[model samples]
Target: MRCDRIEDLLPAYADSALDPRERAEVEVHLASCPACTSLLACLRAADEALAVFPEVDPGTELRGRLVSIAAPRQKFSLFTLLRKPSLQPVLTAASVLGVVASLYLLNPGRRDFEKNVVRTFHRGVGRVEKLYAQAGGITGSIGSFAENLYASLRSSNPLERDKD
Candidate 1:
């Protein structure tokens, strides 16, 4: 890891909350990195110093306060659906709209895509036909040239044919 990034993670590393792999990585980095080691040492000393704040004893009033604060919070359940009675209609409407929207959005390729594919297919076929015609023309010319060479060789007077 880069020295700057390792230096940034030094505080978290000193806290020992980092995973084993992360701790090893930091350890490897700290071995070669003096700046990060110094930062880690400082964070460690600060944490050790903060440990002096002794835990406060909770009084009877504190217990009452905690219960009062927590008493109104109801446990969650699937039946919470029926309590908000007005939300049900809106949620139902939204769900229907979501279904319609999903069906439209998730539909197969549009007409434009199909049209483009067909057009590309026709263009590719046209190119292939043109290539085939050009090849045929070249091969036909070669065949004619071969025939003329054969006829010329079949003649008894190969040199006299030039005088004609």
Candidate 2:
């Protein structure tokens, strides 16, 4: 194997974490590569230096706080959602809008009013379409004007025009 591949396995080999087959492959590579062997020696030296510092368990309160911080939050609930202060106004507005829409849709006496609303919507849409068509025509004219201006500027030779 290449030195680069063997270099990655050096740390695992130092800790005796690699499987037997992997350990054998790393050993074969390390035998041929002086750099990998030196790296493994350095890792072992660092491990020995670190081993001098004895591991200590954290205090009970600190461990409790850490566990609380890492623990998952309470499961989702609709009551929790409804209790949010920030969402109160939004929920109220949605509720009011729902009531209004249901009332309007469910009213049998407003059948003629609904037809009038539909007619007004159609009329507004027609006006908007006409305005859009006019705007398109205006845009085409502006584009044509710009093209003509650019062509005129390009066609006019300054030297000839000055001589004339």
Model 1, position 40, has a per-residue lDDT of: 82
The sequence of per-residue lDDT tens digits that candidate 1 reaches over residues 1-164 is 99888877777787777889988999999899888888888888888988886888899999999999988777786789665888888888999999988876776866676789899999999999999999999999999999999887767576767666
Write model 2 residue lDDT over 61-150, tens digit each, in one string. 999999999999998999998999999999999999999999988999798997899999999999999999999999999999999998
User: Could you tell me every candidate's TM-score relative to the true structure?
Assistant: 0.30, 0.34
- Candidate 1: 10-residue stretch with minimal lDDT: 155-164
Clash pairs, model 2 backbone:
none
TM-score of 2: 0.34
Q: Model 2, which residues run further than 4 Å from truth? A: 1-102, 105-108, 159-164
Model 1 lDDT at residue 6? 84
lDDT of each: 0.86, 0.91
